[model samples]
Target: MSNENVAILMSTYNGEKYLEEQVKSIISQDYTDWHLYIRDDGSTDSTVNLIKKIARDNEKITFLNENKPKNLGVTGSFMDLLANTKAQYYMFSDQDDYWMEDKISATLRKMQASEIDHMPICVHSNLTVVDTNLHGDSLMNSSEEHWSDFKSMLFANCVTGCTMMINQELKNLLDFDKVKSNKLYVHDWWIALVAAAFGKVVYLDRSTILYRQHQGNVIGSNKKTTLFNKNEPFNGRVIRMVKITSDFWQAYGSKLTGQNKNYVKNYASLVQHRNPLWNLRIVLKYPPARATTTGNLVFGSIVVRDYQKLSRLG
Candidate 1:
């Protein structure tokens, strides 16, 4: 185990085009106490070769699974890195994004300030949405004031992985075995849920990175689903939400607070009831918190109208 205070975990797959630039950004960070761990997820391109070359010149960088690259997808690759690395603080990185020079120092400062003795803590920040050419657009932040709450996190995730930092206590609570069995939506959402339930979630209102948007991005800012889209049905998104929530409950429901446990239990039970009225009743009685009143209403209406379809999807 390296004595570095922070471990920067990055997973790349066919990211040869922008990988070098991202690595350079990490190397240029003002905080030099961090170590970079890069895992190539079975890339057929020259991404692996590029990483090897970069790691050779930089002692701070470590190429993980260098001999055996596996296609574990984004979530799996990140979890794999998390399971193997030991550090006081951990941050996830995307191969295509550009981190600000002060990204690590700023996030670490916030984490240290908020951390308690052996209690889980996660610190996340806003992102500056940018194009492939690094042109900045609007800042991306959570619209929901209570986004760190368990109920809000269960339904909608505003935490972006690239802008997140977690303390060692929070990292220790992450169970890779449960992660393998459950239908998790993403690694970031799971971390948020654990932090919200067992410890504290701190939000930094400032942008820490240039969140690059491009065609190859697995999940980009522009690709997010809006509450209202004429062509897209709301059922798909709601169904995914139910699946993720149910999986989360099954994985960690026992440790949740009494109120949160009931909230998740009732929400997860909606798919079990055959009658739309019954499902609607449950949804009405225990609605998940949303950013706005309109959003809450829309989400409830979708569950009521498409209960059968949502159930089937689940």
Candidate 2:
């Protein structure tokens, strides 16, 4: 290759069934200034061997073995890979998903063109969720506003990890060492939140990936599995609520850095008090990013005139 400007960080764990197809799709990209920085997290199958076979012949794909005595899980694997890269642009990839051809080109264009490129703006796209057999089942879409930067950055995950493309500064800032490095990372939720606080988050709605969902997924599908599906619930809604609220409170209140620390503190406080006024203010105050937040929190409905204006843009 002539150069290496983009670094693709992919994390794989027991993904043999779909690994080859996904890897082939990545290699088929129209863009040439890129390399696949991959780490296979102790697969018991021939998945690592499959990667090693192709990687041996292709210099662009660098296969990093887990040097750790134990598997670091997905977050630690990414941390390790992120530290090892020196590319201008950084992205995270899921093992089982196939990216659209224009995915990187579109993200790179927006990133290179944005005035806030120095800041972390997450350029994401719409994803079509598919079954194991690659049949389209649902749409795992992107956020319309900058809220994915805020809300996802705050409590719950609003954006999918696979559809994201972040910048260099964004990568450096969110890396564990830059700010709040000591906290345990629940994969990329903290990283996205930090990204929103520091940079602008863009929603590129073009469908750009085939996100495959199966029972083994860390965060499985929202719907029940089909015929072979275990489709088991994580208990009832109330029990799920208990854990979710706890996670939100902790992530939001934890000693975070940059602008989010303040926002998180305020949010945790508001939710603790069970106040409607806070959401109302959030709805009224933040624009573009918090449209849904406002509509859901503040007035049950937006002012008709404002809603109509936003609708036209959509």
Worst 10 residues of 1 by lDDT: 222-231
Model 1 per-residue lDDT tens digits across residues 117-198: 7779989988888989999766875454326777777776777899999988998888877668224667888898889888
Candidate 1 residues lying further than 4 Å off, grouped into runs, are 1-4, 142-146, 223-233, 291-294, 312-314
RMSD each, Å: 2.8, 9.5
Task: Report the C-alpha lDDT of model 2 over 69-173, residue by residue, as the tens digit.
Answer: 236687777776777788787878888888888777877776666635366666665678888877885775324322455544343344566777777777766
Candidate 2 Cα RMSD (Å): 9.5
Model 1 steric clash pairs: none
Instruction: Identify the runs in model 2 with alpha carbons over 4 angstroms from their true place.
Output: 1-4, 66-69, 142-153, 178-185, 221-262, 266-314
Clashes of 2: 2
